[model samples]
Target chain A: MDSIIFLRPTRGLAALNLRDLWVYRELVYFLMWRDLKVRYKQTLLGASWAILQPVVQMVIFTLLFGGVANLSSEGVPYPVFNFTALLPWGLFSKALSDAGRALVNNRNMITKVYFPRLVIPVSSVLAGLVDFAIAFGVLVLIIIYYHFAPGANFDFHFTPALLTLPLFLILALVSALGFSLWLSAMNVIYRDVGHVLPFLTQIWFFITPIVYSSSEISSKWQWLYALNPMTGVIEGFRWAILGTQSTPALLLIISTLVAVVVLISGLFYFRRMERSFADEI
Target chain B: MDDIAIRVENISKSYRIGTAPERYRTLRDSITNAGRHILAARHLAARLSAGRSDLARSPDPSSHSTIWALKDVSFDVRRGQVLGIVGRNGAGKSTLLKILSRVTEPSTGQAEIHGRVGSLLEVGTGFHPELTGRENIYLNGAILGMKRVEIERKFDEIVEFSEVGQFIDTPVKRYSSGMYLRLAFAVAAHLEPEILVVDEVLAVGDAEFQRKCLGKMSDVAQAGRTVLFVSHNMSAILRLTEETLVLEKGRLAYRAATPEAVDYYMAAGFSDAGERLWQASEVPADAAPFQPLALRVRDPKGRVVDTARSTEPLSIEVEYRLDQPITGLRVGIYLLTMRGEYVFTSFDTDDPGKFEQHSTRPAGHYVSRCTLPANWLNEGRYVLAVNASAFHVKRYFWDDHALAFNVDATGAPGKHWPEPRLGPVRPALDWMIETL
Candidate 1:
């Protein structure tokens, strides 16, 4: 009797092995770098599109919220406030959009070549980070202009909490990678997932507090918001840079756990579905 | 055994066959199955008189069903050996290569490969149409698992081989299909992996390019690298591979030297009368609107002639059944070379007196005869197709492949036909020089 391997919802967790990914580190870097260069190739603005995105969003939000809605910026310039929130959100949204369908975009590669399938979505997310880097440079200039010097009164005190920025950025990366892995893998067999990605991202953006601060949500609901993962990341980013009341430590703790959980489980599901992608695609 | 570069062990893969017209039907069935599975688990638990911890801990694996594309297939190839895979369409050749390349997992077994693999499963694979040819080369190389520095080292060589120097910077989307195939093949062939796997992608290019690619594969194979080639072209396969594996419906039918395997494949799919015709419908006819009766050769008595002597007078007869009378009709015959090029075309009206008017159906049969002047066409297999059209041939209605035959010059005991005449068709021509 031939033993059959059941690879589905239950076995997904064991199907993905991180060691295989590590073995192909060079491929991952090449794929990520290739995506980064391709995104900016032949463009007149090159890397400026990254900074341009959040800066443009900052101007719009400053006018609409600061100018019209009178939304408080915690005694800081609204442009910087809005730009700060937009940075991580920009990274998350773009990463999600690209990674969500990376498998379909590379269907030729999947069907013809052999490699770690996770590398496709991982590279897409990393490529989006290039835009984040270019956009991050512009944010630093705005911060220098508004605060003049780092201090408590300027609401721009640099603190040791800044060390956790990488941690938070990684959190956002995990959330995007996790969700995109599932989406991209599913998109290979069901094309309708591609059509729904944009609408789902829109809803996801609103729920992440990119245009507003998470502080204003009712305290009773704050814990549930942390379950979103990005909720803690955005709040943590604000805390690290602005030195505001440190993001509710408890929410940060909870969201970090959620992000880890999503990353592992998402990878599991993606690998389980990947074996059939070439045939179906 | 030490020299073996690829070893396949009991590999199997299966897929669920689905119909596009019933796509929704199967989809709904799967959803309903999922619901039933959940409900049945609960029902079984409730019916149990006592709790069974051991049974609850495990799940059955055989409950699902699928059709196996490959089953228990195993093979071994030595390093530097050029292996040819030949089979009818859908015979699992592509599936085997996919498994060897690790593009998809084998359900039951494993293939252990000794070195890096460079595979070109199909044209335009691993190529992004929006990317320029130069960009795609790097992208494809990376995707093929080539190191960046290694790709850069051979990048110029690939461009030169493809003969697309001028269009290297242009996006591949704008390139002609031929140019796309050339450039894509260049990148794949030049990658210089330890093992190269090529599918039927070489079928699209011009004969010259195909010759160049075949030459390259031979050179690569000679360089002590392994190659697994899959193609329908028997002559090309014989020219390139030393060993051949013939597959039929996902099972190994024959494995031996190229010539023997080629013979097996030919005999398996063909009949002894030298008539290789399998499915007449699949082979496109030279004429479209007419149903072909038979294309044969005959002597003066009208008895079907199966063979012809080189020096003997022969009549090529093409018979087709037509439903209605076509005015000013000219019956055309074309002889095509083995490489699929038209060598010559002759019509029944080549001689003025040969044109006959048809006011009604020739009550019994309609036959077009082309008389071959003594020893004109050389000895070889020639395809004879008859076409019906107006005298001017402004619009063609039908062509029938009524006959295909071979001419042997063996009747002249002391002579041998020239080697170049081994092609599908051979024509004797006139060569004259006028001195001024």
Candidate 2:
């Protein structure tokens, strides 16, 4: 008997087609490659801009917050302290914004052709990893420079905690993908999402711990801070790289739970709205 | 094994029309609309609720804003059958293709396919200008649902067919539009799917390229694959498919062999051989002051005809109604070849005397006629587009390509040539051949 495929309008909450996604994995890879390639095209600085962005932000933060405000960095040098957190934060924010606009940016494909719609946002998020890797190299240079700087009290210690770095990075990715899934789907229907995204990301940045450590927050408010998924991710990066704080098991657990919930709900919301994308877009 | 390749069962798609283009309804709009409906129907709430099912089937009688793009459309294609769909603009042709391609879902029913479907709904779809020709080939191939290995296998053939090997590594931004479309078409054509669905993407490219595409399509059809094609070019449709479907106002009007189906589609809405009378409902509300009543084509004997002999004078009459006196109103007819090349535009007031006589027309029904002298038109199908407007003030009403008729060259001056002449008009002129 011939294999048959039946298509019907999805009603209620629809499940993700993991098998179809698996079949189209190559397409996802190519889309990510296209995004990465197009991002740097025709620019003189090219990929160097990726590394330069976080470095520039770190310099400004050190001058404004570290020096002016005398913010505590858990006894570590402010530049090194802020750079570690910035790496994960930078990845999170960039991935989130890029993935959020992915669907609208590929409007031609969305309207003219058909593929697993999830591939678009997923590939945009994945493409930001290349920039993250570049920026991470700059962070490593800063660490090595401070370790040997004269009169510097900083110590370079490699810990087993560094093994958990991948865990924190994956956590950041999941949260970014989660928010992007919702934003991208919403953006197709309501362009207001596009107009409001930049402000939302900026507000989210202030709430997350990048320049200042979470220790600065009052102990009473730590639980509420953990509700922001990036808090655990940024703090975990600091803990893993600088070995400053002990494992915040509670923060990690709570943030991980929130990230998982957001990711799952975002997936379902995206699938529910996927059917109308071609028409609305 | 199942012999059927595609089965569409009672599929229908409806859309809310005449609404703001902003498809995403904001919360405030939805709330206000709901509140307004509730307030207006408070006393009839119970009765309305009871008739909800019937109401859903047909939109509110007072609000004529909903349009069913496709209604209860059902058809089946056996393996290796080539089916063609023909319709006027907004006749639900594109909607049907979108549903079958799974780009959008139908409001009711479903479609089943026994094989993988590849659709080329638009040419050069998803081709980034910054990308090189080679990169874009893979990108477009992937967009058309081709796998990486499959693209790699056919990469050489695609390049050779496109004839852009010299610039394959250069960015498509630097290539001319023709070159870009060639590469795009080549990649799409090489997508060897079991079921191929194509829209009017072949309308691009030069005449030579169009011929090449037509040949390629015929080859695909002859290879025993199921193909569904939609095109405005009836010649291509007649050449490629054996069976055709005609859609009229979101419903299936006729389904038969290609030639017969094309005849039915071309003759749709016409009451007589060469005359069309517009119903009041068919006219949009915006064209209120100048309402088109009827359009007819007649021979010199004043007899309405669908086919005109090129040896005789032919006349076209546009009958319209004016509800109020209008100044500077000119009724004109645009003659064009079936392929959409404009031959000329003639207005009733082109003559200074006529313009002075009827500068302002009073409220009444009137007929504006234009006559084409004998042996002036070529033997081919022609389209008549009617326009009523005041020079630069405003366009009261305009219907582009409103009517179609045929001109036969059986007794035309070109009968001695025994070859087809190109262009829309074939004017017979005085010739004096010298003995030089």
Model 1 ranges with Cα > 4 A deviation:
A1-15, A40-48, A148-155, B21-30, B36-68, B129-133, B165-180, B271-436
**Tens digits of per-residue lDDT for model 1 on A160-224?**
88888888888888888877887887777767777788998888888886667787788899889
Determine the TM-score of chain B of model 1. Answer: 0.65
In order, the Cα lDDT scores of the candidates are: 0.74, 0.86
Q: For model 1, how does the per-residue alpha-carbon lDDT over B48-83 read when each residue is reduced to its tens digit?
A: 746655554323344454657777788888989999
**Model 2 chain B, poorest ten-residue lDDT window?**
B52-61
lDDT of 1 at A8: 17
Candidate 1 interface RMSD after superposing interface residues? 7.0
lDDT of 2 at B385: 79
A148 in model 2: Cα distance from truth in Å? 0.9
**After superposition, which runs of candidate 2 have C-alpha atoms over 4 Å from their true positions?**
B22-24, B30-64, B273-310, B315-371, B376-401, B405-436
iRMS per model in Å: 7.0, 1.6
Candidate 2 per-residue lDDT, tens place, A19-111, comes to: 777777888888988887788898999988998899999999999999999899998999999999888888888877888888988998888
Q: In candidate 2, residue B115 scores what lDDT?
A: 82
